[model samples]
Target chain A: MSPLSITSRTLAAALGGYGLASLSAMALAVTLPMARDQAVIIGIMVALLLCSGAAIWAFSARSAWRAWAGILAPGVLLGGLYLWGLPA
Target chain B: MNKSFRQSMAWLHTWTGLLLGWLLVAIFITGTSAYFREEITLWMQPEVHDSTLQPGTIDMALAALNAKAPDARSWDISLPGPRQTAAELRWQPAKPPEDGRRHRGEQILMDADSGEVVAPRATRGGNFFYRFHFELYGIDRLWARLLVCLATMFMLIAIISGVITHKKIFKDFFTFRPGKGQRSWLDAHNATAVLALPYHFMITYSGLLLFMTLIMPWGIDAAYENDRRSFFSEVFSRGEDAAQPGSPGEMVAIGPLIEQTETRFGKPVERIQITNPNRDNAQITLRVNRDPAVTDRQRGGDPTQVFQGNTGELIDTHIPANDPVSPGWRIYNFFTSVHMTRFADPLTRWLFFLFGVAGSAMTVTGMLLWVSKRTQQLRRDQQPDRALKMVNGLNMASITGLMLAIAAYFLANRLLPVTLAAREDREIQVFFIVWLVSLVHGLLRPNRHGWIEQVAAASLLWFAIPVVNIFTTASHLFTPLAWQHAAIASFDLVCLILAALGGHTLWRLQRKPLPAKARRAPAPRPFNTTNPASEQPAGESP
Candidate 1:
């Protein structure tokens, strides 16, 4: 792929990592049996570390498509699981 | 996309670090100084140095607050603790209509013993450095926090990338060889970066967490339904509100309760906050010193105890039980304590401060190495590049210029007339003005000479501050009067040590001409050797 395509992919991965982090954090808050406040705290901590890891994965990938897959696949999976667990 | 992982990481590291390195330097320097924020505040207000926390100091502080703000709904009394000598008081004036929005009210600095106001020199003191470390002055706090947080995140990225890119990071930690141009700069940067790598990581990450709610509100924003106060109250385990009785009751004396709290905590009570004073259901909250040591436990012991104002009966408390407190809150305080270091003693605080200085040094050296590398390449090609010149000026300005500005700020604090209007703001203005002038000076002058002048200027200013203090105030390095006020004396002594260090820096800069590598290093691209002198700019110093 061209440099421009690569740059775009990198940017997406960065934002995607942040998005995944926020989603997973929200999921933790909803799922933890402890008080809502405590859940929020634990969730945010986990999310911060996850975001950092995701950032590294984004840059280290061999291709832009792979980076996108790395961030989005887990994000969608976790987010979907969170939604499924919620009362309809 | 085909580039190796280390190569790509190097690209990321270089750009992210270059973009925010200057801001990081300033932030690290000021934040490190803030380890002694209260002591700096005290030293600036020299009149309070002789005062000590007397028995019943809390009662005197409460009485002072009562007499001053009788109609106040609540009072915040930061009583003379182990770290502070003045009882810093703030009140919620009954005059301002409560709209659930906070506003600054009357603030007073009183002697905890005498219960009289200590009319010290009006200055922002070290608080200027402390606040500017995170929320820059004269700007909207949200905007400032956002900007700092962005820089912090970038810093985090750079640190991670930096570690990844340097394959021999541990091996390089022991490396240092001065005066080798880009080589020396790289070694210095690596040494500082790798030496206190853990500290650098902890300080950066915890700093971001301390301002987490301010910056990353999404988690709480969702969980608490956007009500910030409710979110905070829940996270902190807010106590139940006491219902007010219609009729007033005779209040129990506060002196004994304060003594009881002191004994209970094995530490002196720092403050006694009275809410709804003189009301039938008034409540008194006593706070003791935060334990001054780092522990691995998830739960921290809160030092606050609440009591019924009328009966002196303990109503609510957050002090940790013998069993570990709530695990979640423990994690929260663990992060908070690491960043704030309220638990650390002077020795530990100094260790943290020195690591912070090393981190700042790492940033400066990294930036200079970038400039030096480009300059050498540009020189070998016999190209006079405008961008190189611009980077040179900025390099001189951001690092040494910042030092000069801080010294000038201390100088201004001492030299400004005692009764000048808006005195504190004026001191801060002088700080910025000097800093701006240094940038302009850096751009216009020859880079090498410009660096020398700024370092010399910084040294002179640092040396002058204590001398100025000797004349303007009672403290001096050798004076008997200074011995009585150890904090003030040590402050002056530290000033002297910094001055000597600055002098040594000035000497080093003068001893070294530009690292003599451009002439000898292999030229990346050949250029005319016939007119090397023409490449030199006019008005160049000998």
Candidate 2:
């Protein structure tokens, strides 16, 4: 659409990619022993989902907020969990 | 984004990648090798033939240490196990009063049986390789680390910008067109970078964080009041807090302590440090850890226990998984774990090794891309541009010449006398001298010829390593292989394979036809004529 929107979309996608990676890593870290493996598998799955979501948002979203939402949702969730639930 | 922003980023990505690519390749190569530093040490020392340690060897080793280094402030004894040869004792004397310079500790290599000092060897063991990646020889460690840090930051930027620049990122995910010069280099770079994107990101970011104290020291320095030891202890869970040393008392038997450590951890005691050993407040810290392994992540969840030196009583315990550390600290640990791969099994180590090679390939291709892209412009310009030529020379020297230097270092390890004074330092000296020599060779030769020559030299050196080992060592590849000795033979074989690849590369370079377009002389300019009749007459004659 508009150049501003496209730039916002690109930034959103970049953030989304970073969010996916961080969340996947954090999820794997918090889960203990046997559940850790399962957590990592889930994390990988989630990361892929987020990555695909970002791609779709880049192409399809008419509004910049929607593109940003695709990334921010995962980023905020991951950051919150890491700060609050991290093992001592 | 505006075209200027995109263009600026593109320029940033290109130059940053080009400038740092060679250093990055060195880093990846050394880092990967550092994963097998212990194995390399084992290969270097043929005198300690087998992995097994003699019974009561550690006790005897300690007796020697007590006798030789009684005045020393602290003694660290590393017990011989599967990965190392000889029980080694290191003791650092107090700083001298006049100059206040600390002496580099005395290292006594004890015989496994008699516990007498063996002929001193100069090899710095496997740890040197680990140290080489961050603390490059001849450079201050702080400066080297900073350089590495800058390189890593640029690398991260390049990775991010590269992804942004790739228009068909997913569509060309698996594409690799083999022989189309510049296009092929781009394809190779993209494939390597994309396929291992996770590895690339983790490695680059973790590498940067590896020196985070240097990069972002405000938190750690402010918190610890700039006390590095305290910071380390708090972060790494090192050194127990104990009461002041009491009067000298009878020390307890270390055998039971060793047995206790082994039994508790299901791993052999790697090292034992007795703090204030002569006093009643003596504390024995038994370091029982898993044999270092190579994996995607190096340090795994393992516990380190400390016990009282005299009573064999438990003092304190540090388990990385259970330690109360900040998220930043844990993140740092996670990066180290990934970088060192100490927790990995053999199969996983192989995976990391392959990835390390892929990382090296990414750097090499990036450098090659610089030259490949500029070749067209240089050809179009009748005369060879000096700046482009210099860039071409530097790319060749760094990419191929560094490999030759490393090969030369391996050769020097074999050639250098073991009994020579400061032998370890000498070996390291050889490494730098050879590297410097390669830089000179690169600068002096024609750019294209330099690559061929350096690659050929590297190939020869790699080929020679096994033959030299066979001549010098008792264990050769033909001998029945054991787990402890397999690394030595395998390393040699890997060198040979590298040599073969280098040879093939050199051969291909030799065979490349000179550019047909570049070879043609520039079209002669027609003589200027003011007379219109003359110009028409020329056209008519033609």
Candidate 3:
């Protein structure tokens, strides 16, 4: 792999993965019907797992672009959920 | 496709394990020592070693507190259990001074048996290690915690990728081929990692969870609308001390309350918190030793009995097992509590400590395996590159050099004059200085000589601790008082045990042939070193 490709994939794994995890946390926190505290905890816990999974996906993907796409797709979905669930 | 996936995972595991691996090793060692935090604190304060468990220890502690701070707003007495010898007495003054400066309440260590004040030397004790475990010393607290959280994330990823990369995890658990350089290190690494796989996973994941609020606050921010404090209040539910101080009045006897709470909980009371003491509305809350089996919420779940202090009337009772916790909170509490070993008995704490040792061994072997593998692949005539040499020196400093530094820290605790100003900071300085010296030593002599010398020096320092204790403090290894105080005795014994281990390692290193014989010939082809398939044995592929 080229140095540029590795660096791009690393950024995708770190920043993109963190972005995806944060989105998941926000989406679950707002959408889950449970109490806010419990929802927040469950969201963060699952988000951490998703972060690791994103890291693995970033490395295993055939191309760095695919890595970003894989992480961003779910992130976009979670962002939508978060926005829809937000209180006016 | 399967093979490629495994190879990529192997690649991921190697880098993730190597990058922050040194920091992870230091974190693991200190964090493991924190399991004995109270005991280490006890050992450091030799002035209280004679304060063994006695009947009516709580009564004496109360008497001391009442004499010291009779009109204080609150009185807290932490009675010594198995891991401590001193009754820690803390009292919050009635109010802030007229100048409105924050009044940090005064604390003093009293002999649990005698109730006489004991002034031990001023040192950070185990708190240094405990605080350094998460928020490292001498750095901004936020940055230190953030760095630690990042290393923890890397650890979580490393563990996951490592499992994916290992083709025969169970089979490798049973294998330990001795005397082959890289192969032996690999075997040790596999054995330790697989043996404590669950523990490693729990510790790393829970480590991240412990700092989840700081690291992953998005959920809380979204749900609570950026009100982090409200989220904590909701989760922890620490009710405000509502009752104001009433007129000064006689308080109830604490002895009966202690016995009553112990009988009710089937465990000895660990602490007594008296709010609005000597007032009409004085409240006494008795908390007993935590039962490890209880997987309740970490905060506010101890089995407690509250009494109207002046009236001696039972106000409320809390049995943690009877309390209902949400499933998510229960899971969170279980992992974080286990990681802290907060409720563990001595035996269980020891088991966790051993598991921590195994975790440390896993990282050490993994680091060694990396160096050994690269060294083995080195061409016979080609010298090691600068990066390899740098990593080798760092490995020495982080592993054995760190051992030497801790020994120096303990030695500084003993050697530094008890009356010296800023004594605790001085001890910490000694630790860092010795560690820095070892780093230079490692870089200068990153070879067989450096390992032998540093290991020998650490071993000597550890061995010297008990011997020096006899001359410096009354609670030496041979003293009867040492036996009476289990914490002090165990601390010295652990030192000796570690010293022996270091000695054994030194002996093994000496017996082994020099570096030349350890190195293998270059691989048959000019193998692409970056290829994961070329790194390990190829027989696993189907």
Candidate 4:
């Protein structure tokens, strides 16, 4: 099977992209020095934009593995940092 | 695997559009209708056709409420305004039952003049179409919302990719040739799309934005520790008040409070809510019905004002979102206003509805174009494929069949007995059953017969609505319609227009049968695949 088949791209975008967006939103919410309500609101907008970009990138990428890596690497880093010592 | 940007975008556009186009069409149609949902709901309930808004209506309503729910804890009176024909009144007891489905009170419609109960039909108001627009029926709210969001995202992707693929699309807007088979469809698709390009983009993006928090609430969940209410309180400043246990105090006249509220705000009041009525802790809250500004700031503008119930003295008031709003609330409200069109005037509402219909037409035409192209290919290589057959049937089912189902739904509302329990749910059930039957009808024929039959049925039903309304209710198309109650006449007119349009299209389809040009050779070969199936690939010409 081709590495950049539509099916693989879909999986990477939906799963990996979703994880990245979710993790980044949490990280921003915790780290931003603004009020929590403001931080969360801004974080959500950022996450949505990031998610849309990831989806577009997933389909446009030459290989599906790169799509997965592009999303999951940042996702895991933020997720790990969140787990370590991020404020609620 | 290797393709140019435009080619890749073309591929994405076709797939994404095909994958979610049916649902998109459904959403567009229902949502567009929801823009006129108030009119549709009024048409459905003919009981309040004569109850026009007049002077002294507020005083009458106040007297009615004071007499009806004297000992009640709270009184909420929504005076008749745009989209509403009657003064909607509700009151709550000090000790209320735990019923979340309905509002927290015994609700009833009060006539503006006499303050008599205007018992309209028990059907779900314009709320049905509005709710169905986002959260479709027969599903959990969360699940329905998520499904709609997913489809919306796919539609966004399709729109973006489509723009990329159609580089000279602007030129196509000015180019259209009638009577040419594929050219006509392309022209139609391009014309409708390009004409309402901005509206389509705005509506689609705002639709996605409307459900942003529900779609991406991780940040909110984390910040508020999964408590959504706290975030809501902080962002949207709801009028938080407490009721005290005090002895019964001399109640002040509501007419004075109403006068004071209107005078104080320099705007017409739409509703008033009295918490702890007739008690020392009573508070009167007045809501502005219409924003004086040409354009509304937020979805429901903060034109809410609270007054001391006993003294009729103003306590607090909130203006529109001009005040400081929490982080993303402004953007959220902007998108919401665009999507909901709640702030739109009648003319703007009509434009939105028309654009929505045009968008639906574009989707339907695109689907038909796809089928026609495939049919040509099938004729060139004559072997019946299951997928092509299924697509043909599904298109007929969703496009025209849904219209038939909506018509049937209206007919059911009039025919069903008012005394029947769960009549609203049953009416919805009738709608789905009729839709399901039409789908079966589509699968059975999938040709000229299917198209003609379903469109004809829908047209007849559209015509029959006004006829039935005249016979069953007081309102009709040709009757003398007053300006205040013009919605009823307008409803009838809209139906007549739909009937004429449907009839004209059906007549044209029957006269020409455009599909004949596309599927001349593959017309009757769906069932007979023995001899022709053998020599299928022999004459394959690209």
Q: Which candidate gets the maximum lDDT versus the true structure?
A: 3
Error of 1 at B69 (Å): 3.1
Please give, for residues A28-78, the per-residue lDDT of candidate 1 as tens digits. 776788888887788787777677777777877887788888888999987
Expressed as tens digits, the lDDT of each residue in B304-411 for candidate 4 is 778887887778877764665653656656666777777778888888888988999888877776666565445433644667666767887788888888888888
Q: Model 2 off-target regions past 4 Å?
A: A1-88, B1-8, B49-51, B70-75, B92-105, B124-132, B219-237, B240-245, B290-321, B324-328, B377-383, B478-484, B514-518, B521-542
TM-score, prediction 2: 0.74
Docking class of 3: medium
Which scores higher on lDDT, 2 or 3?
3
| Model 4 bad stretches (over 4 Å) | A1-4, A31-33, A73-85, B99-103, B225-227, B290-300, B380-384, B513-542
User: Ignoring the other chain, what TM-score does chain B have in each prediction?
Assistant: 0.87, 0.82, 0.93, 0.90
lDDT of 3 at A19: 93
- Candidate 3, pairs of clashing residues: none
Residue B523 error, candidate 4, Å: 15
Tens-place lDDT digits, model 3, residues B76-96: 888887877788898887775
* DockQ of every predicted complex: 0.54, 0.04, 0.69, 0.50
Candidates 2 and 4 compared by DockQ, better number: 4
Ranking by TM-score: 3, 4, 1, 2
lDDT of 3: 0.85
Worst lDDT run of 10 residues, candidate 1 chain B, spans: B533-542
In model 2, which residue pairs have backbone atoms overlapping below 3 Å? B37-B126, B298-B337, B298-B341, B298-B342, B298-B343
Which stretches of candidate 3 lie above 4 Å from their native place?
Answer: B1-3, B97-104, B515-542
lDDT for each residue of candidate 1 in B87-166, tens digit (9 for 90 to 100) = 88888776665765556767888886688887887889888999999998789988998889878877887889899999
Candidate 4: Cα lDDT at A65: 76
